[model samples]
Target: MTQQTLIRAAVVALLVPTFALTACSKSNQDQAQNAQAQLQQANKNLEQAQQNLAEAKQQAAEAKAAQEKQAAQKKVTEAEKDKAEAKQKQSEAKQASEQKTRQARSEARNQAKSESKPVCSDCGTISSITPIQRNAQHGSGVGAVAGGVAGGAIGSQIGHGAGKTIAEIAGALGGAYAGNVAEKHIRKVTVYRINVAMDAGGTRTVTLNSADGISTGTRVRVEGNNLAPLH
Candidate 1:
């Protein structure tokens, strides 16, 4: 080959390598761009997945909160119902206690009345004495006789018959006066009065006949025309 031919051939060889290297670099650059794009897409997918997961978690939390709220409401309702029932029971118990107390009072009053007979208040005894003044006359006469007899018997033991007779006369006169006064005083009946307090804050005055052995604070029953005195 000539010198000119050899130089042209050598130039062509160097240009071919340069063209090939340029083509290869261009191909590599395209590949790198594609990989970057794929990486960007993957990152976007990951972000989307994370967002979906957060949304699901939020939904679950809301559902749990709602369920807890419902459970708490149910418990409150049950507690309220229990409180109401307890209140009702307490009311019933109070009513029953009141009723029992009333019944006991009534029974006690009745029992007391049944045991004692009717009596009066003034003399502390019951007397069917007629013509109340006659009681005094009769008692005076009996006392006089008794006094005279006792006096005469004592005088006879200490003096003569005439002195004894005079003493009997004096004794009888004094005895009659005392007996008449006693009989007058004993003829009257006793009277019992009580003030009763009612449940409604009211008070009642109860009057009944008083008798012997009957005392204050005694339970008694007043019947028709007869007052039963209690011991």
Candidate 2:
């Protein structure tokens, strides 16, 4: 063949080998770059997931703490109510006991007053009243002597000698006895006898010249030998 054609063929053959080698090296570099980009994206997504998990844990812990605080507050309120109720019951019991004690004291005092005894020593109740009469004076012998002398003189004037003497003696004796009886009747005293039962224990009798205001069932007081109204 010709010399120029032969040289051209040689150049073509060398250029084609150089171009294929360059293209293959470029494709390998591109594949490595794409793999590195995928790895970086996966690392970013993992970090975001970890942050979200930590936030959720923190919110759960806060909610638990709030519940615990509310429970503690409710227990404290119940305790305060129980204390107030106990104090009120104790106060009512003490008041009732004091009232009962006061009532017992009042009853005791009333019983003592009802059982007391009497105080007067000279007081008495009049049980009986009786009217009586007594002679104020005894007969004197002077009246008897005067009446005998007058009766003897009168008898002597009526009769003679021995008969006059016997009549005079009989008249004198009768006149003396009559004069004594008249003297006793003229001097008489009226009185009242009162019988009393004493409070201290015995009975006594009192004589009064007059029964003006005293009667049976009357209260009286003894003074020396007399009695007075006790009202």
Candidate 3:
């Protein structure tokens, strides 16, 4: 072969190999840029998903808190209702107790009245009369009359003369003696008597101030008197 042809062939061989290497390097660089872009997109998508998850968690927490608050409110309302019902029941019970107490008192009073005994209306019981001393001047009525006359004479002395005063004194003395005699003749006061049974079954006689006609075996109950079973 010629030198010119040989030199040209060698140059061609080197040029061809250099061009293929350049092409292969460019292809590899393009592939690397594509991979980087895909990685960036994946990171962006992951960030968006994380943000959505956080928002969902926050909403769930808020809902749970609201539910708990509602439950607490319901519990408080129920407690108040229960308290009101209890108070109503207490008031009703108190009213019932008061009514029962009143009924019991009324029944007790009726029982006491039923158990009471009747007594004589006239002379309440049989008793003795203590006689006043004889020759004793019964001066109660006469003293009242004489005192009035003496007071009148004293008052008359303030307005009238001696003649009026003398007449007043004579009238006062005469009226006092007549009243004394009448009181002595007519005052035959009789007293009533009573017999009370003691707890030991003993009988006691008591003198009363008024006349009483209580026959034997006559049932009697004194006023303001009470009897109870011995303890």
Clashes of each: 9, 0, 3
Tell me each candidate's RMSD, in Å, in order: 12.8, 16.9, 13.6
lDDT of 1 by residue, 1-231 (tens): 999999999999999999999999999999999999999999999999999999999999999999999999999999999999999999999999999999999999999988867543321223221221223224545555655566555555654688766766666666566656666666654454544333234434555443455444544444444445546
The segments of candidate 3 whose C-alpha lies over 4 angstroms from its true place after superposition are 1-5, 113-231
In model 2, where do residues sit more than 4 Å from their true spots?
A: 1-28, 110-231
Residue pairs with colliding backbones in model 1 are: 120-190, 120-210, 121-189, 121-190, 121-191, 122-189, 122-190, 123-189, 124-212
Question: Per-residue alpha-carbon lDDT of model 3 for 30-125, expressed as tens digits?
Answer: 999999999999999999999999999999999999999999999999999999999999999999999999999999999987887643332232
Model 1 segments beyond 4 Å from truth? 1-9, 119-231
lDDT of candidate 2 over 187-209, digit per residue (tens): 77888899999988899899998
lDDT of 2 at 71: 88
What do the candidate models score in CA lDDT, each in turn?
0.66, 0.84, 0.65
Q: How close is candidate 3 to the true structure, as a TM-score?
A: 0.45
TM-scores across all candidates?
A: 0.45, 0.38, 0.45
lDDT of 3: 0.65
